[model samples]
Target: MVVLATKVYVSGDAYERSRDALRSLVDNEIGDLDVEYTIGVREDNFAIVTIEGDDEVVARNVLREAYGEVTPNFEDGETYLGTLESWGEDGIVLDAGRDIEIPADNLGLGQGTPIQIVERFGLVQHMPLRFVYREGDGNAGASELADEERDRLYDWTRGTGRVNVNSATRGEVRATVNRAGHANDIVTVERLGLLEQSIVCKEGTDPPGLLAAIGEYLPAEIRCVIP
Candidate 1:
């Protein structure tokens, strides 16, 4: 059994749809292998995947490579996936089972406070981020965003025509864009969290224009990151 790092925090009809989507995703990732798997969403919002088959080890590795494994303890210098729980003047707090705080100075994504960094990265609440935890005395166990990860997010802001939408599932956001008759305006909908998605506008397509066209169809709040 492998506990996935990410959470599935939706409820009602959205909950069911999200579970089905996750199951399909897991199946697609491990279907070709000689493995039979069952996926269960826990009350704590994490997904538990159990595999039993001839190639269980291989299947397990495949799943881990696709969806990071959730561990009960953090190791020094090891990168882990965490959800953005809260932000304050001190720093950003992540819930990786325990509270992992990344100080504002450790953000390393440029100037500003923790809140400002969150806004600059277009990070939505509960969105997952990768970080490395360092062990020390007082501030030891403090986490820092991985340099490569921070650079990847910083690069996104440099490009124009990206629409970042929060509080909606990828499936729902994609359906909304299609229903709004602006499907051609988007190249892909990148999943930032279980609910947050970033719509990458197609070449020559304006992000703000695409957001305006589909704003009415989506019930969630949408924000645009202009280059």
Candidate 2:
């Protein structure tokens, strides 16, 4: 089964209004599938709605068409948070908020900066509710992919064991590019990591580094290699 993500905006002093809109849209478009909704504060006078569904293609199409009836503001750009250019490749690069500033002592969400929503569309998304891997010897062990890589690399490593990020190792990471009786092209896993990081520029890549192509793709946290 595939899952999809859709965003909805809630209107002023109107949590009820937002809920109604979301319910109506979900009822109409994804009326049949299992639905889970999450609401979070977004800027002023509005909240963000995340609707997750079972079938990705059907869910997205239904939501897009349903906007005509429920919340046209999303289509008219009236409710749009910002254009695509404002978003870096690494999702919404939330630096300091430029528009609003909250007072430190006020005890409320004071003037905060503009909100950037970095919505990543993915299929097999899993959160590490628990981690069991450990280090071996004095040597740092296996490497791991960052949180951001989970979604993009999800499809590639579904049946390929867990995600391994080799950022700490000096030698190359290896993978089989082509196969011949369980043996294929011995590509360095480091190369895959580099590809994922956009460190190397592939053919037809305008920019030299694949990392640059990823646009602001930085590891949220640096993890040492396990021994």
Candidate 3:
């Protein structure tokens, strides 16, 4: 399934006084519905944000439900930052339901630093079952799900080991993959940065030219035979 990159421009007169408040409401509500959000600026009574994931229809429905009239816009492709979780004296905590003792510093969660949730499993539910790391905390959570069971509905709707090479009209592969390729691995030979590269693969695009460029510019480990 192709996951789309989406931007939601939420504007309201209540934004000036409650930027974070509005964001929190939207984030929590949408998150409950399993929509991933990357929070951006909190200014001018408007919020600029980007979201990417599989539950597009559910996300739209939740947005309207929470904001009373949220306008959700969809785009073809994206590099997206997964949701961020932070631990502070008064911030969100991992709802482990049990105290798993560990050094606070090891988790990178002394008191106020937010950490990123890298992996998740189970049917997407209002209560997110996340693999989280605190800034100073040391432990990481991972479990091997039976491949057959993983394919079953018990693991929520999130499926793993899938990829999309199709580019968007903006001339790039999914944003999350594109940026990750540049930052974590040296795939595309970029001059400036991953996000700055002018690349796109939209419907009816020239596949041959793109394949040639990928062969010529990208690293061998990152190369692929476009079927």
Which of the numbered candidates is closest to the native, going by highest TM-score?
1
Query: Candidate 3, 78: how far from true, in Å?
Result: 32
lDDT of 2 by residue, 105-210 (tens): 2111123321211121111111111111223322133212223433343333332222232221112112111111111211223222111111221223222122
TM-score of each: 0.90, 0.22, 0.21
Per-residue lDDT tens digits of candidate 1, residues 129-158?
889988874444567898877987888888
User: Candidates ranked by TM-score, best first?
Assistant: 1, 2, 3
Best by lDDT: 1
> lDDT values of the candidates?
0.80, 0.27, 0.30
lDDT per residue, candidate 3, 59-174, as tens digits? 75565443322123212221111111223322233222222222233333123332221112111111111222223323333221223432332222232211112112112333
- Comparison by lDDT, 1 against 3, better one: 1
Clash count list over all predictions: 1, 19, 33
Off by over 4 Å in 1: 137-141
What C-alpha lDDT does candidate 1 achieve relative to the native structure?
0.80
lDDT of 1 at 7: 78
Looking at model 1, report the run of 10 residues with the lowest lDDT sum.
134-143
